[model samples]
Target chain A: AQSVTQLDSHVSVSEGTPVLLRCNYSSSYSPSLFWYVQHPNKGLQLLLKYTSAATLVKGINGFEAEFKKSETSFHLTKPSAHMSDAAEYFCVVMLTGTASKLTFGTGTRLQVTL
Target chain B: EAGVAQSPRYKIIEKRQSVAFWCNPISGHATLYWYQQILGQGPKLLIQFQNNGVVDDSQLPKDRFSAERLKGVDSTLKIQPAKLEDSAVYLCASSLSPEADTQYFGPGTRLTVL
Candidate 1:
């Protein structure tokens, strides 16, 4: 079985400061990874996805993530944070095979403060 | 295009009562998925459908939970004799196809079992 672990349960960053959310994965085979964000009362929105194409994946809202196969990590990062960036983020791993089930990590709540 | 659509943004039902949720996927999407997300935990796949056929339902609790996608466009999930543990957010997502990597999500229906 494949799974993802979000190291931080909550992250706080000041406006204009950098933000980082850590995630690690455990999968028997090469896996596809994704980052999704959910604002208050909103649906989950895809931030980016890594499908063995590019190691550095750029996503919407100036967010990005790097897929490091060596460390089995795909951490989300932003050069600068904004007040609107506050939301819950999820790290997901797509299970290999037919069904292509997605295994999500315990979300990390991000708080952007002024 | 319009994203996935789910009805009843929030629902409250007594224990042992039955509840149902509906979802309408994006136009032209050939695959749909249902997930259960407990508070403070990640979303887990409960079922998957390709068009109007069932693809993977191994994780779904068949005794209490049942889902169907008729005409391959609209879907419904029902839980009979709901339990406290079943109180969670039910999310619906759809992709262009089973091979498509991007799966757009709908605003989840939050279920609270009293």
Candidate 2:
């Protein structure tokens, strides 16, 4: 009943430049959106979340995402990309009524260059 | 606080072979979840447990997979007869509150079947 879509399979950016990873979702109820990052051979880490209370959510490592109800999107954006930011990013969606059952998008691999 | 921990970071097995992976979530985390991430894909929730009780397992490959969280702390996932298509990284995540749904993930067990 709920689904997320990562529009870009890959996003390449240079260090110190802005990074953008697009994501969209469809849910019958009000949706909670999240962004998670995964380094090679590592687990996914929470980047940011939009709990419906705030449209613009700030997360660790200077990452942020804006939840747009009109567009049905919650795209992740960072002012600058660090070399350490090279990793795979995921878009997740869930319904508050469901109690932590999350739906994940395919993924977006970010390649940060020097 | 320590993050989620998983054992047997990597495992290789032949078709129809059985295998199991273990996970220890963060201390005091009441909600635990199991997910499968195929290469190039995001983590997919296979099961969710809240204090020793199952909340969801709709996406789980019930025919080939089984899991338990008896003590409501540590958990395990087993594949009775893995197929080549079963290769993936098994991720374990935990959250403080089931309703909040901000999950922290483990490094995961990568299983490769030939």
Candidate 3:
């Protein structure tokens, strides 16, 4: 079984300040984790992924995430939040092997206030 | 390259009405997925197809939901007698292959039931 949990239901960050969205996961086998951002009325865009490669992964639009095995977490981070960064973010876990199913977290709504 | 495409960006219907959504994956992508995202919740997998073959439909409400991926390129999902609870956003995503973890998503179709 694979599952993900986003620690915060909503996060408020000021523009030009740092941003952090915490996520945790549980998987039976080697897991693949992903962070996706969805702007209002827009598609879910890939922010970053952790597939047992680098613990720290950089993504588009100045986003990044760190995979901490001992913590069982993959939290998204950005040095500075922009007004355009306000959106809903999801943490997903993919089950390995034949099932290849993805389990999504409840999501965290980030509100960037200027 | 062009991203995944979906039609009928918005739909409004009454209870018991039937509806369908269409999706066109990115060129050369062999894995397709349909996800349902309820308001305030993360996207949930509805069905998955690999080269026109059904890979997973466990989370799909098979009694009313049906999907098909013909020619391993285009796909469609249908819901007969949709209930009020079925109102949500339907998201389409595609990956390069069955084992690929990162996925590109479409803008999604928002369905409103009355």
- Please tell me which predicted candidate would have the highest TM-score against the true structure: 1
**Residue by residue across A3-105, what tens digits does model 2's lDDT show?**
9999999999999999999999999989889999999988898888888797999999999999999999999999989999999999999888657678899
Give the distance in Å from residue B79's predicted Cα in candidate 3 to where it truly belongs.
0.6
Clashing pairs in 1: none
Question: Each model's TM-score, in the order given?
Answer: 0.98, 0.96, 0.97
Task: State the weakest 10-residue window (summed lDDT) of model 1 chain A.
Answer: A94-103
Best by lDDT: 1
Sorted on TM-score, best first, the list reads: 1, 3, 2
| Chain B TM (all candidates) | 0.99, 0.97, 0.98
User: Following a full C-alpha superposition, what root-mean-square deviation does model 3 have from the true structure?
Assistant: 1.0
- The stretch of ten residues in a row with the least summed lDDT in candidate 3 chain B is B95-104
lDDT of 2 at B73: 96
TM-score of candidate 2 to 2 decimals:
0.96
Q: Write the per-residue lDDT of candidate 2 for residues B1-114, one digit (tens) a residue.
A: 888999999999999999999999999999999999988887888999998999988989899999999999999999989999999999999998788668889999999999
Number of clashes in every candidate structure? 0, 0, 0
Give per-residue lDDT, candidate 3, residue B19: 97
Candidate 2 stretches greater than 4 Å from native: none
Candidate 2 lDDT for residue B108: 95
What is candidate 3's local distance difference test score?
A: 0.92
CA shift at B19, candidate 2, in angstroms? 0.5
